[model samples]
Target: MTKEQPIGFIDSGVGGLTVVKEAMKQLPNEHILYLGDTARCPYGPRPAEQVIEYTFEMANFLMEQHIKMLVIACNTATAVALEAIRAALPIPVVGVILPGARAAVKATKTQQVGIIGTIGTVKSQSYYQALKAKQQEITVTSLACPKFVPIVESNQFQTAVAKKIVAQTLQPLVHKQLDTLILGCTHYPLLRPLIQNMMGDGVTLIDSGAETVSEVSVLLDYFQLANPNPLKKRAIFYTTGSTALFDEIATQWLPITRAQSKKIHLGGTTNEI
Candidate 1:
């Protein structure tokens, strides 16, 4: 739990980079260690037990790196594993749901908030519960956008087809009179442009990943783990799947030019990766 120790972030895939990007912007001195289980991605449609298993696998891998803290950047994983991981680990653990809910509650003028996430996330009702916990009278509407993850993972986020899918998938929330919409899944922010267009300018988009960084900053300060050095630090990214695709997405989405990435295998007992 040293200040120089990198903060670990894990997700089903590259979507967690959205959170890493914000952390880089807000906590420039802190180093980052990111892991994306791309091989078992889109935890959206998977069963809750399976999602919990996979989430723990990723957490175990990050814990090996001696990260000062852990951020559950994936909404599906956060829905199922945040508590277990927090209890198991000595370091502080942060999840994206609570921060996004707080942001939506603060931003909403009409008390109507819409949430879009994966099937597992929606089924778990984590966002719904979090929002209600914050403000009981707030109206919450949640939808599952399972297809959105594959689009971002494949780097098709800017394509015309992606735009159409965003429009069609989010149509139900457009007329819900939501003043604020929480991008419950970390992957959703990469398609933020399309989502904003579909929901119109009046609907404020709350990026849960970005919001999670704010919480991370607070925790870092409170725990006396904030890095004292001001120099920029290189971020390390590892994917259980393709390093090529993961690097491509990281280069496009992240602001740093010297981002380093590698491929790692998770299931075997050997540390072959």
Candidate 2:
């Protein structure tokens, strides 16, 4: 694969833009292609098989564009489909979970950590397993914030409504004695300010999306995919839902130019990108 080819990132919704923002900052020379399955968003509650089907469909869409690498930016998707997709794909694949887990494992001073994600993500036990795999003795507490993604996706994260929702949802983790919290879902990073506020100054928050890009940078170099003799960066975003809403949220959270987002359907083989 050549560096000229864009790096692909996929998520259940605009949450993946968090990763795109970091990639733009860390890999300024590279191009980015992102697909948000907004049509079937909040993959949190979906069955694992359904999540995998959707993840592969998104990956196939990105592959058609000749991406050099794949970053599964959705926590639920990473939890359910990362391994299967990685094995099937020829290109290098990266996911948000391990990077965040690795960072959390290293960051926690108390050996007590917290993970907040979607229902599917938390139920799959991906983050907890990933954390334990890295360091067997780490104590983990996880919560599924089913309400968080809708707030972010609806472009209400900075609103009082969103704040109340975050506070209500995060009440449990506040007293968990955790020194570090993993924003396991890509969408959670969009709610980082609210989360950080609730978790307070003493608790460090880990954004899987942000951390995933660091690994992306390293992989790009290791795999000889770093763009050389680069030009101005470019980003192309696609969604299966309303482009207008995606544009609104992405403009505020990502480094992307505020343009009309392209719409693409990802389902059975009959669907087109």
Local distance difference test scores for all models: 0.91, 0.89
Off by over 4 Å in 2: 269-273
TM-score list, all predictions:
0.97, 0.96
Q: Candidate 1's residue-wise lDDT over 135-196, tens digit each?
A: 99999899999899999999999999999999999988888999999999999999999999
Candidate 2 C-alpha error for residue 141, in Å: 0.6
Best by TM-score: 1
Q: Per-residue lDDT for 158-265 in model 2, tens only?
A: 999989999999999898899999999888887888899988999999987667888998898899989986666488889999999999988888755575689877
Model 2 has an lDDT value of 0.89
Candidate 1 has what TM-score?
0.97
